[model samples]
Target: MEKRNIAISLPCTGEEEWQATREPLMSGWLTQGPKVAAFEKAFAERHQVPHALAVTSCTTGLHLALAGLGIGPGDEVIVPAFTWVATANVVLYCGATPVFIDVDPQTFNLDLEQVKAKVSDKTRAVIAVHLFGRCLDIDTLRAALPPSVAIVEDAACAAGASWKGRPAGSLGDVAAFSFHPRKSVTTGEGGMVTTANAELAEQMNQLRNHGASLSEEQRHHGPRPYLLPEFNLLGFNYRMTDLQGAVGLVQLAKLDGFIDEREQWAQYYCEQLSGIEWLRLPTVPEGGRHGWQAFVLYVDPAKAPMPRNEMMEILQAKGIATRPGTHAVHMLAYYRDRFDLKPDDFPAARDCNDHSMAIPLHNRMDAQDYAYVVEAIRQLG
Candidate 1:
């Protein structure tokens, strides 16, 4: 194995972040403080939503969202089988069953027909993930889903993505976003929950900070600054630190440029790989403005010269890194054994788990790196 020169994912942070983080560290007020409030305000304004509560991670944000929705035992939450397991795991945290459904074979998004088929009286919500930064069809979901069931957009990979000119965070009833290093904008490790409903937003706000009726900043800054806060309900300590908030401000400002650079690189990948008959490239649906978080491709094993895993191995040997797009949640041991699920139950999802490949697509890559990835894959023929 040679020394790898290209990375599959990288955070494109610069002096702005270093300079921003200095104040938070120096001030000695690192918990959710002024910086966190500023970040929340900026994020809410950017998404055109009334509320945005910063959290420790997207996983916690999803948990808080489901908890806020009052989804408990016996309720079912429909999840796409082809996403990161966290989307479904949160339902488990709420003591609810996660009903797995197949995604569209082409777009790799939630299949509305499958969703309609799965919804029942016990259905409480649906977790619509914007996988790889492409916005799922919210309009069709709005029209098809009954008012009794809620929609939670897992916009983990979608910061700049939009559908019909509306931002991803604002499209669904409530949304959760990630600012992990791999995301377009990063806070090292942080998440945000956005919603138009004041009641849900207030509940989640309390739920993230030990169920406090008043935050530390609120209590310390008000007229009765010495008073301790009240804990009204059960909550988790999922608050984002001021350090991350400071970095988030810098990253949020750079998000659009990051997306633009990623889109350009993605187009290059598409153009260079277009002639390869064995590759199935990603597609942007009619109204979807892709954020291009990651460039995922499907390798048809029957048509390709090698199998998907073999192709990944070959790429790895060439000093290029690649990964499966994501796992089929149902096929994982816990879900399979717990629910008595089989791999063939959701054919499209199983095929995706076996064949879908995520290659290098990030702001850190240059033309030379892109060329190497394309040439390496082309050689597989």
Candidate 2:
């Protein structure tokens, strides 16, 4: 295999995406409009949920979910330290304390046992992030939590993934999904919140669009045109644009095909890298369908002849792009200073954070690129 500059992730867009954008542009209603509503409807249908609200990004969706549930100061939200910073940051956005828990070594998701131990009187909710496109043990987690505690699924990476024949977004009280370029789908930048509860869905819709009881589309289409709207609660301008929604509709149509390609690429990686004793491939549990958002390999520095950083340098020098696993949220300066946390607080998260690396797993990669990445790994070993 020859050296090549393979990116870790890339958005696969083509003529269909361009056409979607063109049609929305020609409509002259670029803000939240019919396209956004159609995207929300289609997304909700795909996830088997009753309602879906399109937002600016997954971060805002999480924030809206928390706010809609009235989680605020004096409340504690349990989250995984192994996830992206936004997972923890959303808790802070709600003025709630984010209690970080270590991740399971095998699944790279929140450790259920640790979650059980972290619950307290102030613990109002648990934000379960399905890390690296792998679904968490939602049933087990739900059973462990007290009935009063709410479960919010941060399904940013596990959009099309499932657990026990149930869709990822439908497992929790509310779920947030991303349409960023790095994800399986792209809307330039957009997100959706899905829920089965009509009241929660309505509240989330209101919270995402400046706390208005009705959106512009509803007001404009109604008999009353100049009536003043009611502001029941505080909210933010987190609405997705019609253009983004149009692109999202097209991307959603291709999601299954994209996921199929990702699964195939992941299988190739597992097969080719199995012989590398120092590397640990990601594990997908039984009854779980992973979206393969990222093909992460854990490099055991103790067993590997080369250090993790050295192997990364070697791979980069060979023109293969890679990335460190998601940041250790507890160790980040903001969280550390705020919580006065030490590395010892969450050993598993710290260990995984230090050693894990993400390889290229985009839908665009062909057999040759996959072979090159495999060869690069073998050379590192």
Candidate 3:
């Protein structure tokens, strides 16, 4: 029989996405306009937040969130060492130092205990990442941090995920969410910042549109035709196009269905791979809901007869795609060289980076494909 190719991650798109695009194109007003505003409004309402500002990407959203908080030079922002570089890069973007903290081995999120030790008078905020679609225990983290320190969630991988019955984006003071192709829903390349704080939301709104109090489209139709909007702060052109917004609106509607399908696939993988001593399946904590972004398994090289790299190669030959769980931010070349850090500094993150591998868990997978993956792993044993 011919082998079937399995992708580690694939965006779910269909007629709805195409219809969304067509309508936006026919509207004529393409740049951040009614469509974008409606998307932001609907997103905010979905998350039960007061405001949402759509931007170019999650990275820019984080930057704007940090800027809105007035976190700049001489400040420190705690970030997980095991997440994407964007989490820490935003801190640097604001002229603040990113204080790296090791993640919990189980959840692959910032360790709450470690977060306490890292806090200081200079600590301005903590960028808590809901890694692999699992929400970090924000209540515990909030209890650990000083009252003055703001908590900004890097919920890039979490769309419909929740913690203790609360939505992911609403758990923190401000949160950034991604709409990248791999996410549960895609806007091609877009992001949104959610917050209940009115001032922060207003600031983020201005920051995303070149520091103008009113966006150009809003100003054009206003009575003050000759009045130029005031620029209160230095900002960036991080506006999301109307086309992306239209697609996102349609995608957001299907987010619950996508998450449900992904969870079902995850449960199937767990059932098939449970007895394999060499592999550690992903876990969801009590009272928490995971978005099931990527089904990651940790390969124990000692128990497994084959090495990690060898296993990856074998899987590739079998037409299965795999990827490393997020990078160890502290050990990345740029951060290591710039900060003079070593892998040993963050032991847990280092271990996670070395052993974790992500497998396919998209909505399209069926039982046969999953069984094939399990049998391949059994062969390795």
The runs of at least 3 residues in candidate 3 whose Cα sits more than 4 Å from the true structure, single-residue gaps closed, are: none
lDDT of 1 by residue, 5-124 (tens): 677899998898999989989989899999999999999988889999999999999999999999999999999999999999999999999998998878788988877889999999
> Against the true structure, candidate 2 has what lDDT?
0.90
Clashes of each: 0, 0, 0
Instruction: Please report, as a residue range, the 10-residue window in candidate 3 with the lowest summed lDDT.
Output: 1-10
Worst 10 residues of 1 by lDDT: 1-10
Question: Which of the predicted structures, 1 or 3, would earn the higher lDDT when compared with the native?
Answer: 1
- RMSD value for candidate 3: 1.1
The best candidate in terms of TM-score: 2
Candidate 3 local lDDT, residue 133: 97
Better of 1 and 2 by TM-score: 2
Candidate 2, superposed: residue stretches over 4 Å from native: none
Could you give candidate 2's per-residue lDDT for residues 1-381 as a string of tens digits?
656888888999999989898877886889999999999999999899999999999999999999989999999999998899999999999999999889987789999987788999999999999888999999899988999899999999987999988988999999999988999998988899999989998888888889999898889789989876799978899999999999999999999899999998898899999998988999777987898889888888789998788888889898888898788988999889988999888988998888999999998888899999888788774
Candidate 2 is scored at a TM of 0.98
